[model samples]
Target chain A: AQSVTQLDSQVPVFEEAPVELRCNYSSSVSVYLFWYVQYPNQGLQLLLKYLSGSTLVKGINGFEAEFNKSQTSFHLRKPSVHISDTAEYFCAVTHMNTGFQKLVFGTGTRLLVSP
Target chain B: DVKVTQSSRYLVKRTGEKVFLECVQDMDHENMFWYRQDPGLGLRLIYFSYDVKMKEKGDIPEGYSVSREKKERFSLILESASTNQTSMYLCASRSGLAGGLYEQYFGPGTRLTVT
Candidate 1:
């Protein structure tokens, strides 16, 4: 079975500061990794994904994640965060299977950006 | 833009009531999914459909059921709504072709409150 683990339940940071939300996954087969963000009262929006590419993946809203196969981790990072960037972030993983049947998600990390 | 719309934004129901949450995707995608998002637990899949009249159970489907009579629409049914079942329900769709490299489009989400 595949599973994802988010290290932090919440991360509080000041505006314009750098932040990282750590995620780790365990799967028997090769996997596709993803980051998703959910704002208040809104559904999740894709932040980024790593299918078969370079280790570093860039995403919308100046967010990025590094897919470290050696460590079995995909950690989301932002050089500078804004107040608007405060949201809940989720890490998800699915095996590299054809037709994609399942996606396992970790408990989210709530990012709280303050001025 | 790919659009996934839910039937309601907010709903309140008493326990033991039969509840139906609807979702429709404008994109001619082949797969649709239903998930529930909680504060720290993130999004947990309840059910998914790959085609019309075909459904599959996800990781958490004990209190939920689903229907996909048509390609573009999927409905989540709760036979007996309970307090523990109150959550933010999200609907997502993705193309089944090309090995699902494309991101899943999400609805705004329905916040269900069970009493």
Candidate 2:
């Protein structure tokens, strides 16, 4: 079984300020890590993913995350956030087998950006 | 753009009524999924299909059933709608690639309110 946790339920930041959303996972085997963002009343869009190779993964909208095996974490960071970046973010892990590929998501961290 | 289309943008159902939510994908993708989003709970997978007529249970399948009669369509069925079942439902599709890297595409979700 795999589980994901987003350490914070909400992270409020000002426009142009740096922000980080923390995520951690517990799994017995290798798994895929992902970040998704959801705008108001919209469905989730993939932000980034960590499969293999380099730990640093860059995603759309100038967002990125680092996969830390030692810490069992994959935290997302943005050098600067925008007012449009205000939305709910989710961290998820996918099990490899079954191609059933279940995504266990964090409770989510709402990113609130203000001017 | 990979388009995943949900049949309804909003739905209002009475308790104990039977409900059906439909999803369609245009990219000929091999996988389709159904999920529900609730406040404080992020997104929980309800069911998924990897191929025509194939279905698998997701993390939260207790109150829902699903069907995949065609390759590009997946439907989630609520046997008996309950107030607790009210949620924003999402449908997604993934184009499988070699080396296990796949990006999921999402539809604009359906907001279902069970009264």
Tens-place lDDT per residue, model 2, A32-64, is 899999999888899999999999999999999
Model 1: per-residue Cα lDDT over B17-109, one tens digit each: 999999999999999999998877888999999889999988899989999999999999999999999899999999987655667889999
Q: All models: lDDT?
A: 0.91, 0.90
Interface RMSD value for candidate 2, one decimal?
2.2
What candidate 2 keeps of the native contacts, as a fraction, is 0.61
Count clashing residue pairs in model 1. Answer: 0
Per-residue error at A81 for model 2, in Å? 1.0
Instruction: Give me the displacement of residue A113 in model 2, in angstroms.
Output: 0.4
Candidate 1 chain B worst ten-residue window by lDDT: B96-105
lDDT of 1 by residue, A77-102 (tens): 99999999999999999787756557
Task: Give Cα distance to truth, residue A60, candidate 1, Å.
Answer: 0.7
Candidate 1 similarity to native, TM-score: 0.96
> Residue A57 in model 1: shift from native, Å?
0.6
Candidate 1: DockQ?
Answer: 0.71
Reference contacts recovered by each candidate, as fractions?
0.67, 0.61
